[model samples]
Target: MRREEVVAQWQREYDSFLQDCMNRDWAKIARADEPNRDWAIMFEVDRSFINNAKSLLFTIENRLYDVLQFLLDKGADPNSSLRRYNSDRRCYESTTPLIEAVKIGNLESVKILLDNGADINFCVERNLSDRDVYFNKTRIRVKEPSDDLYIKPREKRTDDEKMYIWKYSTGELANMSPIQIAYNYRHDNIVDYLLSRGATMKVNIRPSGIFPFPFTTLGEMLRRCKLYFIKEVGLCEERYYALRTQVREFESTKKLLKGYEVRNAVPYPFRIVSTAVLLLDNSLEFKFQYMALYSLFILEYWNEIINSKTHIAAYAKVDDIGYLICWLVKETEYSKSTRQSLGLK
Candidate 1:
């Protein structure tokens, strides 16, 4: 047969396969998109790449896990990737079948893919623009009228490093691994499973992976707590005095923390930060206590907070502690010397 004839035949087979998928015909869907019996060959006809879409990718996208496994068993490339334009980020995102499975929260598919030839650490690189760098640096979160917080063009970065995202200049592309995507979507099972399978986390970590939600920055997290208290708890000036009285109790909390360090003979910045994080929790009965502990924590460790990127919230880009306190927390009682000591201008 001529080359044209062969191309026409393959197109017909692909169309037929797609139709079978639509018709929910599992038997027909088992057939490949090519006329030839080489099941491993990815279905593009006549030497054409054709957008890099593959049958395995499609099966994963459509939640056809059984079909996905069938293809993998038939020697399909487990790591076959597809590239598509992400309209929200205004950039091209390249993803693989495993990443898609993680997105859909299907651990079975994830395990199957990993059991096959899928690369556990497969990463897709997207170039970060100037705006991306800026947003990550400033840690800005935009609030909608619906009272929900979101950031535009969310980018994932390494969780262990400090301002590591900043090291990437404008137009610098960064790699986001599969484990990172799992963390972003809150698929804890997948994360733990990946870890068990020796999947490395050096390449994964969202803006606020340590927090309950994907908050862009520490300031954003604090703002969320403030808004929740004001809206749900009716935070008002009338309660300020009572809140202050409750805040005095933070002195004991501070002393307890200090005694912990002295007894252990080791400084625990993470322990301190975690305690501070709990103070911001809106589920607490006394939401006002966040004010006092927050202030005390800053006053006690402002220098350590600003100087060490690895100590506290690295993704928050907290280059200046004093500015963060004054602007986000709105503290007014600090004197010039006190503010100066806290690194406030």
Candidate 2:
């Protein structure tokens, strides 16, 4: 009954429980379950914090739900951080149970965690900040006149304010909303679901360094349309002409359109860029090069427009295409006309 003896006894009990869990000896675990089974002992195990439920949720393995249910029944804490077992290279420094659910797109797992009181907005110190400041900074204001007559009197507020005005702020993951992540990954279904569940679209969430001219989102949409047309319908002159017409319409709307629209358009140009890159090694030198150069210029113009804004939200919704375009131009050779067309020396 010395202190050391008590400590030794607890250690033995903990090790036994760990072995039972690892071997999945459910009978032993149940038998060993005392009145207050001291489930914290399981947390002390080296890999206990790492949930098998996560792998199951992500569909990396099968039958995860059953395992998770068993663990929860045995007293697994859903709020527990798995950083101890997760490596630095893994997505999001340490994997939380909720994040695992999100990545897997498993509504069941997400529901279970929510029911069990999992912190949906929990911020584990991975590379990105938990409360990204990205959402809070996004500007989605309705323009209103101010009292000042001499100066341009437009009042602006954050998207958070607009959401509050609309009474759409019940979900727990408000800090870094899951919808934002869905948008980042281009998970259309998830994005739609999140929006249905009260996710508000902010005008300023466009990816930074994009521009208004040839709007990035519009370009992206066009690119996707072209790819679909080529793969599904085959590349016909009519289809190509149709896409060009849309691009022209986009270009004409340059000054009036927001960055979000541009980011949304990025899919169009992205497809064209992909095709042009593939064709670069073939016979159509000038045509491919021209398309590529035009794409980059459009991206550059978008970036300039975003950066010119005083607020960060102005460029938050823009995609990463601008940076990609800049990189492409730096790495490739360009024609004289291409350079001149893009206003590059």
Candidate 3:
């Protein structure tokens, strides 16, 4: 009957309302008696982000990407993240949704997070021994409890120092990033998209002993192709998809490389064509065996066709390399007609 009791009851109702929303049961959220609650907590911190008191955005991060867009549109903080937690072990974990998306090779969700300003450099928790992420927080100190002892909780360390330490000792374990995860997962397209959007590839990565990498985006792809060939992995699953999108992305990549205009980089496209050709020599059994041959003619004649002033100007210039290649092929038919009329070979 008292005002405090009434507020408590309302809080309980709102909690239930939020819980439903977190589960993405939109019907239940809409059916709630509290009409204002539907949109009210759209901007509130999702304290239940992890298990309890973690984050709210965790709700739709991976599964309900469209719902995530709605929440972002309605003013949810795009940079929301939570410290890792391992409830089974009752310890902290590093399970941010972006990292999870990258791990799972979900390009769409990864792009959504990155497009909305998710931290691409967000490090995966360094659990070299598979230790709990928050072992430091769990580690009990001397409890000096005074400024004269170690720096007090309220003072001393700069914000940067107060957090994220031991980066160097940990190797790439401490610097695991979204692009690194994508590359490791063989989600080549996600890696390229992340790089184009400014995710740095220079960070130290896991198994650093393997290759001291400072690879450019395309360089990494080519490097991966080389590794696959050396390892004799029968077929890269991505090669199938790569055949569908690589030439388009590859042309776009060439446009990007021109920013440097390094003379050496001029031959980089040719090398990719050649690399595909060499890989095709070994076996036709590899998945996407067709791309190697397809890429060869494109490279061998791209300059000749584009530069010869041969009247490809009639086809639609949609900025699509695939379309351009098809158009070029079609132009050859027209050239044959003109040659026949002129009695040329």
Candidate 4:
């Protein structure tokens, strides 16, 4: 179905659900039957047979604030987690209504959920795919023969010779949190509000690609900026030709230093340079991406770097890069000499 059709259906379902709320036995009317017993084990966990989203999640995704408020008041769980099978990944993925709100870029819905006791730091879990488990390009999984075949030992096969190999697909427990998801989806207002509410990073996502290790959202943003510099600035502008060596060194040093904590080990100058390019760039796309990187830094080291009293002081012991970030973010004036020293135009 088309996107509009799907949205319209959701609206219709929500309307019917809202109307049913006036009835005293609405709970019974919303409860799911068999095949969905796993998720709808409770009365407040009603979901459609179609999408398997909880009523609260569906309402939040659709931005139906009135219905959301009514459901929350009617005892719908603010921290309810829905576990549904992902056909694409061939495994179950878990999501919360708060995550849904963040994904839809609805700050109001996010605030409502958080205000109503939703877990601020909740992370969604998606079961690992075959490629993730094998660390390979192959996506095929070997299907073991039925246990019934093992029950009756074949002519030459002894029962003791046969062993059942149970393969358990490990899921990423530290999946993207609401704040991280907000950053990913470029919801700046939601990111700021989540930070204000004491949200922190809990994600450890590692895609099955060249960089097969977990990195912070800040590190990812830094890498993105570096790519932008290489492609747009270095290749396109003769003025930045001198930066090729610096960029290459930054990439190598980043890879070498990224032992365990990729975020902490990212070279300071590299971080500053990458972030500076993004911050100074005129592109609207880079501006949005910059906000995500900025928000991530705030969450990662708010007290130690961003909001620290000493970091911004004249005699601050912090790295110059940290001071520069804090300084530029505040939009303070920089002397011509200072701008030239940092190679900023």
**Ranked candidates, highest lDDT first:** 1, 4, 3, 2
Report the CA-based lDDT of candidate 4 relative to the real structure: 0.49
Order of all candidates by TM-score, from best down to worst?
1, 4, 3, 2
Estimate, for each residue in 43-113, the C-alpha lDDT of model 1 and write its tens digit: 43433222224666667667777766666665677777777777887766678888888888889889888
Give one digit per residue, the lDDT tens place, for model 4 in 72-180: 7766778878887768766666888888899889888988988889999887775565336553343333232333432232344554434221221122232667877
lDDT of 3 by residue, 1-345 (tens): 555655565567667755765677766644554344333344442222122212224444435676555455545554555566556744444656677777777777777777776777665554333454464443321111121221223145556443322233233243456766675566767766776777754333222332222233333323333343323323355764565364455545453223222131122231222223323333433313343324333433333333222111112111122222222222334367643432223
Candidate 3: which stretches are off by over 4 Å? 1-62, 85-92, 127-167, 170-173, 202-345
Clashing pairs in 4: none
Tell me the TM-score of each prediction against the true structure: 0.46, 0.36, 0.37, 0.42
The whole-model C-alpha lDDT of candidate 2 against the native structure comes to 0.42
Can you list the residue pairs that collide in candidate 3? Answer: 46-56, 49-55, 84-93, 85-93
Cα deviation of 50, candidate 1, in Å: 13
Residue 264 lDDT in candidate 2: 44
Which regions in candidate 1 have their CA more than 4 angstroms from the true location?
A: 1-13, 21-53, 129-171, 203-345
User: 20-132, model 2: which lDDT tens digit per residue?
Assistant: 65566767656554535354444442333223333223322242565556666666677765543334433234556765666656666665666676665454333322244
Best by lDDT: 1
Assess candidate 1 and give its lDDT: 0.50
**lDDT, model 4, position 47:** 45
lDDT of 1 at 197: 87
* Number of the candidate with higher TM-score, 1 or 4: 1
Residue 217 shift from truth in candidate 3, angstroms: 7.9
